[model samples]
Target: MIRKANLQLLIDREYGIGKHGAKAEFARRLGKQADYISRCLYPAEKKGGKNVGEDFAREIEREFSLPVYAMDQQRLGSDTAKTIDVEGLPAPLAQKIAGYRQVVEVPRYDVAGSMGPGTEPPEMNMVVENMSLDANWVRNNLTYTKIDNLKLISGRGDSMAPTIRSGDAVLVDSGINTVEDDAIYFFLMRGKLQIKRIQRGLDGLTIISDNGQYPPIEVPGEREEDITVLAQIIYWWTGRSF
Candidate 1:
């Protein structure tokens, strides 16, 4: 028996069932009726009272290159349902699945990078603490491929307000130090680390803040070295402030 949620996730990921006409296409590829396949996949549903047989389950595993046994082992009320253990799976699949279950620790510094009116930046000290994020979430959301190069920094000031409030924790990819048009970046200017949206033009680069109160600053394109792009902002976490 397979848990309906896990079965659905596997089918959606492996067979592209969420797309239009994919269910029919999947059934066609398996040489089975779509209705029968649906019933087997959703045995608890009123219209789907049939459980998937071992032969059909093996057939699905062979045809789709899926870990059917691993999914079936996730059935509710099973002895091993307490934890998600992929030890029984093949090496490659086990490794891939295990990666999702793993967590990545990103270093969080105490220093706050000004986002509004500029201020003298503090020397970033040793990592104050580590923030743990899901490996899969980090891989999916970040532009950079390397996980170790990620760092967490706090935002200061109200220049980037509304979008990035003060005290927000931002995930920065230090590996990405180039200016991407209209994208937010953390960089050093006049010895101070700042977060701003950088837009490139033929004349120069325009550094902007979301709050209209702050005027944009222009820097010559040829003098790119004047500002050392520390990292690119990937994700942000903030709480409501009164």
Candidate 2:
């Protein structure tokens, strides 16, 4: 689902404070009317206020020259090591995209997928920075189930300290939304965000914290629906010069 918050973030980045006629400028940039922009961002309680649809997201990417489905991604670039079909593009364009199979630009968003004792997660997939890595390197280094689903985000809290210190970053496979293995998972529980090791048992799942100070949170098979597994924590770092 394309979150309306993401679109609002894009507009804010392009036209924040000091940008005179921000709304109109943003609308013009998207080839939309100022009134339409207002309608999209208008409060839900307001009449004629509608959430922006998938089509609008496509238009945004097309207008900004972003990759296809860029707006829909919660994270970016991973080496699927699979072939990328560039069959329908113009000769030169196809050749350019074909080269992309070797390397890809990965996004790092400003939001954090809280490690424990949570905080609210960003509703939008806003890209603040991007890093490029070889497809082979990603495929070899990161354990992932889906290609083009890994995006980097910061981590907070010490519930998973040592394993994932505060201010650290993690590359999450946003595509994997299940307890495939007894590994670390980035998930949502009771409307809050958490990143912890989840042990899957016949009964259900166990949310664990590496720090002995914090106790485990259990999700019995009956209450498994209470937690939403957003992704699996594939790789992590201290966000330093290491």
Candidate 3:
């Protein structure tokens, strides 16, 4: 996932003009023969691919004239590239690594007639689109339950250590903004998703970290542009043997 993100950014930085370059490059990378790359961005087309899927990587290499590769998720920081020849990658691998599509059972509510006491909990099938990473769920899906499609993303940095040790997975809630006093959350600041706690101050929102070694991230009125509440962390799962 990280490799795919880095790949996207790398491509964007190369051909995207005023941030529009990524879209253009994505179209080119996908082999769009027409000039639809410059079209409006509201077409609801799910474009691009992520790691564990090498086909898209090969396409990017061919389109951008760059060496595109996917690294192992477990040892993401290393130089290991499980190379697959551009012509040998199977199409099913792309579909599988792209995430699996599942139907979520939603209750069908009656709106046309009077309310009844013995209401049947009709199972309405709702398609949950497969996302690149489970983290993408926070942005793509709408929440219905407190634990709706929530996922535990392994901590990357040392800012939230001990309570959430580096490489430990932290359970995050995508439903409600239950910003408690010291709970950790997946925050979005400057187009990046980070883990931090919300500390309310007299003047602004201060992003507090568990390890006091680092100072609190204060978002004063002047610095309001710095902090944005993407989602709050309801639970933290730590110390898994695997």
Q: Write the per-residue lDDT of candidate 2 for residues 1-242, one digit (tens) a residue.
A: 24465566556445542234778988888778898887888777779986778798788878867677766654321223357688987999889777665555678888786776787877786999986555666666667766688888888998898789888868888899888688998888878888899999988888899999999988889999898998888777654331
Instruction: Give the C-alpha miss distance for residue 188 in model 1, angstroms.
Output: 0.4
lDDT of each: 0.73, 0.75, 0.47
1 against 3, candidate with superior TM-score: 1
TM-scores, all candidates, are 0.58, 0.58, 0.37
| Model 3: per-residue Cα lDDT over 187-228, one tens digit each | 656645577667766786777667778787677767766655
RMSD of 2: 15.0
Candidates ranked by TM-score? 1, 2, 3
| Residue pairs in collision within model 3 | 16-21, 17-21
The reply for model 3, stretches above 4 Å from the true place, is 1-145, 177-182, 240-242
Task: Residues 1-242, candidate 1: write the lDDT tens digits.
Answer: 45455445455454432345556776788898777667766546467356766676677667767554654665222335345598789999888766554457799987777897555766546789997554555555457747888899999999998889898898888898788657899999877889989999988899999999999998987877788888888778766634
- Report how far off residue 90 is in candidate 1 (Å): 11
Two-way lDDT contest, 2 vs 3, winner: 2
Clashing pairs in 1: none
Best by TM-score: 1
Best by lDDT: 2
What is candidate 1's CA lDDT for residue 120?
A: 71
